[model samples]
Target: MKLKTEVEPRIDADERGYGGVCRNNLARSRGETHFYGRCGPSRRFFACSAIMLLATGLAFAARPSRPSPLPNFVLVVADGLRPDELGTRAVPTPALDQLAAQGIRFTQAYAGAPVDAASRAAIMTGQHTGHGRVRSELQVPLAPEDVTLAEVLRSVGYRSAAVGIWGLGWEGTTGLPTAQGFNEFLGCLDLVHGRDDQPAFLWRNEVPFVLKGNPGPAAAASAFEWMLRGATNFIRINEDHPFFLYFAPHLPGSSSELGAVRIPTASPFTNQTWTPSQRIRATRIAYLDEQVGKLVADLRKRNLDSETLVIVTSTASSDAANEMTEASKPRATPLSESNLRVPLIAWWPGKIAGGRTNNRPVAAWDIVPTLAQLANAPLPKQLDGRSFSALLLSQPPPTNSTRFYWEGHAGGLSQAGRIGQWKGVRALGKPSVAVYDLEVDPTESHDLAPTRRDLVAQFEALFAENSRTWSPPADGAVGAAGRPGYPIPTNVITQPLRTNSPPDGPATP
Candidate 1:
């Protein structure tokens, strides 16, 4: 759709600040009309004035009414950010806070899983880990047939671009964003390479290009800046068109296997009295926030602020055990409430009401349907997510599923099902289930399974049903095994060293 344009004649104004018939090409094209002082009378001038007014009115009447332009979309997914760390006194994420203030903040938002790939898969395909094609990190690539958010938006005439760490695909794989409906893809393909703080090369679409920089302690910062530049450029180029930008920034998450975490030497927190790991994590968070602020500012400067929907969320929560101060740490003991719950902020000036907070439960899979609804795009027939656009607009919540399901085998095979206030988790090879009342105990600390036999049975039944419907790929599949559940300790450390593998048997719970 074409943008609306208004034509106004520039005229000299009197001391009262009122303007007279301005001279411009618009007027000249109609006819050579002469005017005297404002409101001055002359038979010829009066005739001309009446004709001009009539012509202008007719022109306006003749022009067909254009529909409102579809708003552009910017989906910014931070690597591993917890809800509490965002906009809190300790973390100081001003950019994210400003976004929350400008739009709606979902108090109970969750990732599909407490890991990267599965959560991202849910976000992209609008399906939970059970229904989504890719259930694990790097284990199963997104099949070409799977309908993605980009594909939906592209079908509706939106130009789509993806930047940063795309965990769905690797080099020479069909899972690349370009193949998955993004018009352009600029960043690392695999999660491991993406985790690299100082990678020698990054992929631009299907082609790989070596970066020109000295590999050192500042590599991670440099890589992040590169991705940000690509994102901004995509926005600048597609400013006039309805575009979809999937900007995934790999920050805060450690890529230590490649080298030391690249903490910006000039970070504001560098001089603070914190541990080395804490400082590094803080620097990354601060840097990521700064980039987000810059991107938002750029949108406003380009006059696209009102015509764009900017969402800031994370794939998963942070993995660091003691990253924050003791007082700021979450009280919840279960991974369901702690690691899975993420910060979700949607910002669109004038379109979405500001300073609104939504306490409704939402999951990462919900993003796909939400974006589809906003863009007026068609969704796949089989989808696990329902549009939460209503929540963003302060309207009544959509007819959505109340129960959210998650499954993983990273550390150990485990499944969790949350139905309203109650959450039940069962590990593979475990006979009993652990249950919690999230409403009363925000943390999944108090397991009500032993006392509440009925609740445990209900959760167990729910988990079994969900698993039957959306089981991960069979053992020894082409892709990596789906890592679900919470962040647990693992024996083998993968590159980037982000997630914790589950142990051999049932967990402590």
Candidate 2:
């Protein structure tokens, strides 16, 4: 599984006209693509080439005419949502269905990892589990050097806000949403506190805002409703300028008691003949749908419908034992396809064509680059994601050269990789591998690894190429209950302030 390297030929910067500025790394300077290490015969030829190269560079870097304003982005991340339950009889989701009817829906979308924190870290940092900072579900804050999607948007004159579960960091830590790049943040700051549907207090930026009469019948409202209100308020305040809102709601999650649903009530499904868990699941789905509908209606009311792009997707797979009702099929675990696949929908009015279903295999890591491309921002150097903005406009996207990689770090190290139609999975501490052809057998009910030796060798090399060594911190990080233990030295200096000023820098056309 060793890799081979080749040395590239060197050339003079002046000869290549490397002084000309290029907007992004995807575009190269004039005469740099084909003139890597070559030389012309005479001085006359070199003079002619420099003039041509300078003219070509200016043309390539020219701005577009009749440029449009920057579009707004709304990302909705849900927990414990299954892809198969969208159009089923168990739950009615008119709002989500309407959203799918207005934009493109991805059929073969997969999560970055099997757990919550790992999967979210991949999405925020534009790196998969192999190279991301937070690989497992541990309560680790994002290191100071880790850049997020919101930070990328902020660089392009776009204000950013977040509500609901913020799992990457908590209060007084570098992983806090405000410390990362969010202008305003409100909701649960840790995974342990996120489970309670009605907590006594939730973090507003860095301080606690107590919920009146929570954990009792006299409670004013559920945490879910409060998050929804906060999201809408942010949108209204920033309607005059470009913005990015991250709304992550914990819905239809597993309860503290085994085999039950985590919800406040079951009013919508009270008269049904289903089990108590089924009733609670249905009610939770209904509430989530209503909130989505309200968000869309608010955008239309403010005349911002055509200027915003709303993306609705799940964070990870549902818990089969507790979250899944009688409608869903048997779920899988430990890097199985069922555990990684989830729903992905994008809605943009008068921008993207509607009623189209895409089958391109996209993972959670692709989110950061996609938003950066849409905002016309510069991408970082160490990213593993390829942007799919062309796919949204009904055009072929940039071809991805690397295979998709995922790993689970809960019990022990497990690995999985996918290339074209072939998919491979290796269990924890097992020597054997299971391969499946996703084109013919999407369910992966049958195994073909016993007969495909060539594929096995390919996977072995792919796994070796994608993996990187990770070392966990000893102590002085955030504890399990969202308490700050001690401060670790890093490069970032963050100020958690509340202001309405727009992001610095003029908007790029």
Candidate 3:
């Protein structure tokens, strides 16, 4: 095949411009002839340059553009916080309410377990309590082989800082946040330490950062204030790059003192006529809301609001659930919705549509994969959670399993699952399963297992498919000691946080 163009060679110039002509550079060698067109004068030069520029622009546009920077993630877990405790009737959380209004709220979201360690483990490892290393509230460290969400993000160039309760592992153990892939860690290391609202010292990575005049009602500073500063510092330092900040505040939760909830100051609630317990709880919640508002404000001030995803959820604890008023309690059982259902709010300005609420069920385990997806990172192996990133973008969500499972080992093996609209609870050694139609009875007050054999069978089948018989490591297997680097003379710094009033007295002046 041959293609040919005929050119009538001529030189000419128009009145508006200089010469308009085309010159051919012809070369012949080895029985081959090549012709190149060269432009002449101002008119031809402009035309030729315009064509070349257009071609270059098209070529540049055709190449794949560089991907947008990965998004930042901030997961804030409030210790012992219950949803009902945040309404106008009790405590008002303006900051949290606004965050929910500007983000996607999950109405039927649940924690991975009824207690801290297991639920936190599930969140970190993307495995439910049935599969994760820390399956119960027992003090245990995650196995070294276990992969954490922080580690997953780190693989894709994220710098992680866990500021607050690193419940999964303690000091000198493989479960430490630093060991688990966090670039920085500051706060309480163990559950015992976490319970101390006025702890004399906190852990900064593997070292003891002493709080010289802390844990006192009249102390010049609060431990929480220090931790919040650490969190904001991390954000300021990593503003230019992708990062994950896990801020878990131990507030409105039980303190080491029996029947006591401690906060530095209960001023706003000090004048309220509520009971001491109620006032303390309200103050703590208010305090938390204020701190959260500040943190988010900091992000906005730094111009990181649009690129960051802030998730606010509560860690479900049976003990914490009981801390609420008797009337507010869901049911006598620990697996009840009141105990398991925690607030799940996701906020990403300019990414997720604001003021949207989704009824789709989300568990604690889903967080890992969701963040991984947002970062375009690879999914870690042996994960049980499916990413809900699509839901964030108002797109069709991932196909989540119809059945959700949870187990707790505090007294004995207790299991619970939700299949469609039916919720079932069964003790591992018991023969009978109590089922409730959650669609009708949101509180699980009416048991239908005795009447609905079909639902029971279905629940049994779901349990059979998902249940795993596993146990936590032996007590001595993992090191539970506090930071060993500190001197014995400073052991006084580890005392329980002090309180100004009795359990029944007013929380503040």
Highest TM-score against the true fold, candidate: 3
Q: Which candidate would rank higher by lDDT, 1 or 2?
A: 2
In candidate 1, position 231 carries an lDDT of 69
Q: On residues 1-509, what C-alpha lDDT tens digit does candidate 1 reach at each position?
A: 11122222322222221224435543333322211122223467668778998988744432232254788999999887777777766668888888998899999999887678877888888877666676655446777677788888877778788888888865456677877878777677767667665656666666555544525556333566666666675665456568889999786674232234564446677677877767777777887898799789878767788889999888776354346543265543334677788889999999899998988899888898899898888888768887899888878776655788887666556788888778888866676799888888876678888799998888878877776444555643344323332122232122221011112111111
- The residue pairs found clashing in candidate 3 are 198-215
lDDT agreement of model 3 with the native: 0.72
Locate the minimum summed-lDDT window of 10 residues in model 1.
497-506
Task: Return the number of clashes found in candidate 2.
Answer: 0
Candidate 2: lDDT over CA atoms?
0.70
Cα displacement (angstroms), candidate 3, residue 265, comes to 3.2
TM-score of each: 0.77, 0.78, 0.79
Stretches of candidate 3 exceeding 4 Å from the true structure? 1-68, 255-262, 322-331, 477-509
- Rank the candidate models, highest TM-score first: 3, 2, 1
**Compared with the true structure, what per-residue lDDT tens digits does model 3 show for residues 1-509?**
01111232211112111122332221111111101111233565557668988988744342232254889999999876776666465678899998988998888888888887777788888888777777776768876788898888887777788988878876567788978888778788786577677676777666664555654554445667767766776676466668899999887664323355455564586677776666666777888898899889989877889889999987884555544455364545667787888888899999999999898888889899899988988787778888888999998876655478888786788888988778998865787888998888987788898899998898888777777878766662333234344332342334322223222222222
Candidate 1, superposed: residue stretches over 4 Å from native: 1-68, 217-221, 255-265, 325-334, 399-401, 469-509
What local distance difference test score does each model get?
A: 0.69, 0.70, 0.72
Clashes (N, CA, C under 3 Å) per candidate: 8, 0, 1
